[model samples]
Target: MIVAAVPRFRHIVAEVWRPLAALFVWDVAVTIVYYRLPFHAPELPLTLFGTALALFLGFRSNSAYQRWWEGRTLWGAMINASRSLARAARNFLPEPHAHDLKRTIVLRQIAYANALRCQLRRQPVDAQVLRFLSHGEAEPALARTNIANGLVDGTGRRIADAVRAGWLDTIQQTQLESVLVDIANAQGGMERLKNTPLPAQYRFFPTLFTHMFCVLLPIGLVETLGFATPLGSTVAGLMFLAVLRIGDDLVDPFANTVHDVPLSAMCRTIEIDLLQAIGDSAPEPLQPVKGVLW
Candidate 1:
């Protein structure tokens, strides 16, 4: 979400000013409290602690990014599945039914995109969803607790109806049904990442570690470089602050931020792609600043 070309230090201050400021105040307080205590390096393992913190945050960032990328890739696969679904319909339906079915399925595929973005962002599916399905279909589609899953189920139901109508051969029905399963799995995976929060322990440790490090760093430097304690503390605080904010920003990639996944833009892309598959001219590409999609 952090796309600005600004220095990371500046970006950190911008994204995490409040927390970093609080850490600064806390650092001063710690320095005062521990002033009476003689500076004892004690072969104090500051470097070891710093290394551990770095590793912990790196691992955390990697895990969070994996979830974000997985969600994006899942939607990419859904786009493919939707197009493939259309192709599969044309393969089996009688000529008259096939064209309508293709539109129906493809339009519904577009609805699925909007519904999913809304679902992920905790927004309601809007009138755009109705652009694809009739009121009878739309009502039931929106009634389910999970709009994304509901739309996915609707796709499967359409295929089932086709099988009942004798439009699709059994093997073809199964093949398309498998696609539905993959779509459902993608939704489930997104939901899993969304609902299952980052481990509380992981978040807690770095936060504690960062604060403790910044709080002690001044003293460690003070013995070697007198009267520069405040400046030294400020520098150490900024470094830890930058690292912490970067980790925090990446921690929840689904959260709405410059850094969060651009689900709305992605859903729009699916809409355009589905329309193209149906022979509609594609709309102009979206323009974004800082190389980021909305």
Candidate 2:
């Protein structure tokens, strides 16, 4: 996500340039028609239209922001649960005897975080995943339809095995299992947000009305503004256009865009923490590039 103190002007312009260009052209055309042609510009209730359009865009923007925030919140929960799982495995499992198992569980947790990140963004299992998982483990897990969920299942089985081997008692097993469940719930929430989108009315009507308002803007102001119609109308129309674009930018928080949640950075955080917990050498945390964390 954009982490700059102030985003560059070019970045802001890039988002809405297409609509801005269209509005400017339409405004100029309307001004020319009013001055050169015999067309009488109809008086429109522009103030009322602008008020209602603002409300529509406001509602859509609120909904989109909520989706974006919820995605971030879910990832936060995932991070916490992963740390808890790693700590539990490290402390609860009998040391020296279950040393390899403890390390395996922690590494698998890191792998699960990266796998979930890839799954949410619809990306393939990459080196990040393979780095944590062994060839035997990765082969079977990658064969499954949902690799993240498969990794969770594999971890659960290993935990169950630890309990059977007397490395962890039933109580300790339940505690670790609860942490896994939290991770699974967080994954489910992210998947739901990625799968289901904002309703059609919310997506369609605000955009339609915003463009319609821009079209009527120049025509409505031509008589009053006269030669300044293009300037006045284009500036007024840009406000609504910019607001409309805000909703589009935030609608999908997992779209792998600059506006999206920084899944790669977040995954890196889990990897660093879990590896450090198990006394393994961990990589540095991901840093933002060009002011975007993703």
Candidate 3:
């Protein structure tokens, strides 16, 4: 969600302040131990441990950022797909949909997007989408299938009916169906990410390595650095901890939080834009709160 990096130290302090505080306590313990110890530093292999921890943290953070970036790009594709699908539906015929019929299907598609975003979050379909249904209709539509699956089926049915009514050609129906497939595929891909968690061992490695170095850092610094052992260990330990937690923060793409995929905002944008196309005068744009869109 935050594409551009802000100040690095500020970012780290904000995200991992608790862990940093814990590490500060850790540093105090190490400082006390050093004052009472008989032996410490260079020969204790501090350089090797620090270098290795740094490399691991860098690699882990980069990999997690890549996953987050890829998810964002896919959602960008979904935005474009939503707009294109609406256009295809409205204009595939000789004339665009009349103000009324066009509004219904367009609203339906908007409902579909909102429902799909909510489904990804594992939340109930939002009222924006639910308002389109009565209680009797809602139960059956949502019974077995996921919101995305149901919405796609409804879209297919609408397109098929349009063909039957001689409003859209067979080719136009097929073309419209193809657009739905792309949207369906995007939803499925996000669902797959939700279903398939990051490998436990893969995530564990960086965390384990970072903590391991932090635990060892004070002992290594004790002999040469004395009271400064705490200072050095705290600095190094907090850095590793900060980066490791940052990696963990981005691993899940569909927790529906603002940082995850911006699914709700993107879906709402789809709704507003498509409503505009259908000539709905009541498009209400929802703004992201505190730079986060839920």
Maximum-lDDT candidate: 2
| Per-residue alpha-carbon lDDT of candidate 3 for residues 64-139, written as tens digits (9 for 90 to 100) | 7777777777787788888888788678644554434455567667777777777767787746566765554445
Candidate 1 C-alpha lDDT tens digits along 1-294: 444555445545687678667756765664564566665533456678778777876777777677777767776777777777766765666777667776787777778877876667666675767866887767777888877677778778888888888788789888988877877887777778778877888778878877777766755655554455566667767776776776676655567667777776777777787777667786665656565666
Clash count of each predicted structure: 2, 0, 1
lDDT of 2 by residue, 99-148 (tens): 99999899888888988888888888756679888888777788899989
Q: In model 1, how many backbone clashes occur?
A: 2
Candidate 2 accuracy as lDDT:
0.90
Q: Give the TM-score of candidate 2.
A: 0.97
CA-only RMSD, every prediction? 3.2, 1.1, 2.8
| Candidate 2 residue pairs in clash (backbone atoms < 3 Å) | none
lDDT of each: 0.71, 0.90, 0.71
Q: Rank all candidate structures by their TM-score, best first, as comma-separated numbers.
A: 2, 3, 1
